[model samples]
Target: MSQHRKIYLASKSPRRRELLRQVGIDFEVLLLRDAPPRGPEVTEIVLPGELPEAYVARVTQEKAQAAWDAVLARRLFTLPVLAADTTVVIAQEILGKPANRDEAISMLSKLAGNTHQVLTSIAIKYQHQLLQCTQKSEVTFAPLSDSQIAAYCDSAEPYDKAGGYGIQGMAARFISHINGSYSGIMGLPLYETTDLLARLDPH
Candidate 1:
């Protein structure tokens, strides 16, 4: 695909927008919402006994499909729709976005002094083709004090991010290191995403 080709981003995540801009990919934000009866549902609920990898991939595909449905329903301009999902996993337990301050603190506490996997799945849909890929990054967090966790949680940055933290935000100080794509941990993997788009228009 041409790097300049405009696509639709089916997410409101600023991180994703920033990453796309960094790579010089032009895209428009395509927000998803239920359209009453028969509308596409984009719930984050994990299926029973779903593994972390499978969970992220499934959600990303669903999000891309829903975005396409919305575009068709609204008769919007036809463009390739991109969607992604991210999740943090530790000891095989998937930690989604925290619901409250306490949950954020709990998640941070568990993450302190430990290594966790950040799984990100990116999907794109155009015409009759759907392409997808999953990226995994291992993040190691330094030992954090109770005071530190509380202060970070109080910043209100953990509420909307997976694993109760954003690697590009204040939580950067907590991450000792990462073994995979940094952008993936931030919610989008630039390398994988670009590659997938390239596949969509292989010249």
Candidate 2:
């Protein structure tokens, strides 16, 4: 198999792009039809009784599969596809991206003064082989006030990010500490991602 110098990233997140760049990985953004229930996009809706780890891994695999399908359907040059998903969980409940400012505030309210799990799953699809891994990080928040949550929600960071917050943004003030891959909590785990790429590429 020919080694790929660049992979196709199956996500629209700028944070993911930035993370990939930080580790000196070359990747092209592969856009997928993400139109909710109307498009062929992968649905993130958690299945009944699905564990948090399983949910993240499933979504990442689906995204990687979707990207591979797009390449074949569109006749694009074949390259390894990399996809990732991140979600915040507190009290065993998975918290996805907030739909509105009120929801964002509410998500943060529940997260304040508590330690939560940040689950990020990564998948790489090359040829008929698929490799995947899930990174779990623990993040603790330094008790936030209603005003702080309101002010943070007023910005544009929370709407597109998981758990209604971005660890690399102003939300850093809200996080007292993190006990795992920082990039993982940010949406992509650099160490795990680099390892997968090395395995995919044949030097």
Candidate 3:
């Protein structure tokens, strides 16, 4: 593999880092406190009349642009910068990170014994060019009992996850089936991301 190019990951997600590492993609994490804050507005937290796909895509773009700006301002690495945002949707309802244990339980209950969509949007910026893509995965959950929900919520895994659960964590027992990219649901779509990067930086 050609190692002349550098890649900057504009995210603090360890899961994303692990995913990239699994594919042997050499990259460095970009940590800039100056990056734009993730607010309810930018995330579009299930507005009264908003679409789920559009909402997630918008947030992904916002995050990518913000990271790009930060990298440019700091004169960081000259290679491409990657950013992504993931959301869980059930019956058109976007379930983001819960604010408290009660809310986490409520979100888990809503997803119990049902099929939901996990949408992940990825954006890549290099020089003046930008590329964005959204990948969707359908995941089926087994009927979750109250005790199970409580136990999962009490764990530290669900606090920072978008759907109040992590597929690779304690919640894996609750997942019956998945019909799309597992890596995408985890936060980054490796196939699409690698394909795009190959096109941009073919060695």
Identify the candidate with maximal TM-score. 2
Candidate 2 vs candidate 3: which has greater TM-score?
2
What tens digits encode model 3's per-residue C-alpha lDDT throughout 1-203? 25426688888899999999999888898764643565332344455677889888877777777777878788875667888889999998899988899989999999999999999998887777788889999999999899999999998888899989999888999999999999999999999888778766432
The predictions' CA RMSDs to the true structure, in order, are 2.0, 1.9, 2.8
Q: Candidate 1's residue-wise lDDT over 1-203, tens digit each?
A: 77438899999899999999999999999998756676546988899999999999999999999999989999998899999999999999999999999999999999999999999999999889899999999999999999999999999799999999999999999888899999999999999999999889522
Model 2 local distance difference test score: 0.91
lDDT of 2 by residue, 1-203 (tens): 22577889999999999998997888999999877657767889999999999999999999999899989999998889999999899999999999999999999999999999999999999878788999999999999889999999999989998899999999998888889999999999999998888777443
Candidate 2 Cα outliers beyond 4 Å, as residue runs = 36-38, 201-203
Local distance difference test scores for all models = 0.93, 0.91, 0.84
Name the Cα RMSD for model 2.
Answer: 1.9
Q: What's the true lDDT of residue 92 in model 1?
A: 97
- The runs of at least 3 residues in candidate 1 whose Cα sits more than 4 Å from the true structure, single-residue gaps closed, are 34-40
Ranking by TM-score: 2, 1, 3
Question: TM-score, each model?
Answer: 0.95, 0.95, 0.90
Native-referenced Cα lDDT, model 1: 0.93
Q: After superposition, how far is residue 14 of candidate 1 from its true place, in Å?
A: 0.6
lDDT of 3 at 66: 71
Q: In lDDT terms, how accurate is model 3? A: 0.84
Give the count of colliding residue pairs in each prediction.
Answer: 0, 0, 0
- Per-residue error for 133 in candidate 3, Å, reads 0.7
